[model samples]
Target: MIIKKTSLVTETKDNMRGGNGAPVITHVIGGEILGNKGRLYSKIVMQPGDSIGYHQHVGEQEIYYFLSGEGMVKDNEETIKIYPGDVMITPDHGYHSIENTGTEELVFMALILNADA
Candidate 1:
């Protein structure tokens, strides 16, 4: 099945996952569609200074693929700069967070999958 861009669900979140500022989240697919395979599949847009706070994944793993702009990611205790084409993975029980540090909007795709799947 194909999903239309106009039909995609979008929302702005404040202090998402404990981060700062509001970030736009466009769902590429809903949880129901993902079933037990995962919990999230979306495109995230963060303006300069916006962030997604540090958090840990218990039974799941998350992946982030940067599309544009620049950002910084705190992967466990290591802080790394992110740019277009960059990809980050947080394994189960791992901690990670991200912040938009560029002048333009930071765009990326995020996917979270159940560890058991």
Candidate 2:
């Protein structure tokens, strides 16, 4: 049995350089959950004036949860301001992106579930 309690806090600036100029830390990844048909990941410390590129999933759906700060979520035809504790989801074939619109950093988590499971 795998049983343990631990305190884990990660600083995005410590690792990962985004394609753009933003900093991100991946708290969980594709292989973290085994035997599962989906993936879970988290990106924190998104500074103001930064964003994640828009993209779509071929055979999956994604769920986003904003933990702190404020931001904007853009899709094919809309851009919505997002506040802390907001939960947004993307359909199987929808496209979306996220941007930090606040002065401080934005932290968000994403979960992707593949359809072919």
Candidate 3:
């Protein structure tokens, strides 16, 4: 099966997770597409000053894979810089957030998977 670009869905959410600015999310493969095993499989774009505020995963794990641009991630209350080819993961019971600190836009891929009990 093939999913074309035109068929994909995109949305822009303001103050996402108590963030400073809005970030665009382009859904590549939605949860329903994967039978709910995953919560998110999408491309995330954040303009300068944009961010995804700190949040916790109660029963899941989240991964962020940077494609281009630069940003900072809040991992376990620590701030870490991120760049292209960088991968960060927040396991179950973990907390994290991300902000685009570069002058240009920051693009990355995000994946959220359910944690086994």
Best by lDDT: 1
Residue 108 local lDDT, model 1: 99
Question: lDDT tens digits, residues 1-117, model 1?
Answer: 989899999999999999999999999986789999998999999999999999999999999999999999999999999999999999999999999999999999999999887
- The TM-scores, one per candidate, come to 0.96, 0.75, 0.95
Tens digits of lDDT, candidate 2, 1-117: 342224333444522223244557565555356336786565566778777777877787778889888988886669999998899888788888777889988878877877555
Q: After superposing candidate 1, which stretches have Cα over 4 Å from the reference?
A: none
Candidate 3, residues 1-117, lDDT tens digits: the string is 989999999999999999989899999986787665877899999999999999999888998999999999999989999999999999999999999999999999998888861
- CA shift of 86, model 1, Å: 0.6
Sort by lDDT, best first: 1, 3, 2
Judging by TM-score against the true structure, name the best candidate: 1
Q: Which ten residues in a row have the lowest lDDT in candidate 1?
A: 27-36
Which parts of model 2 have CA positions greater than 4 angstroms off?
Answer: 1-19, 32-34
Computed on alpha carbons, the lDDT of every model, listed in order, comes to: 0.96, 0.71, 0.92
> How big is the positional error of residue 42 in model 1, measured in Å on the Cα after superposition?
0.1
Model 3 lDDT, full chain set: 0.92
Q: Please give the TM-score that candidate 2 achieves against the real structure.
A: 0.75
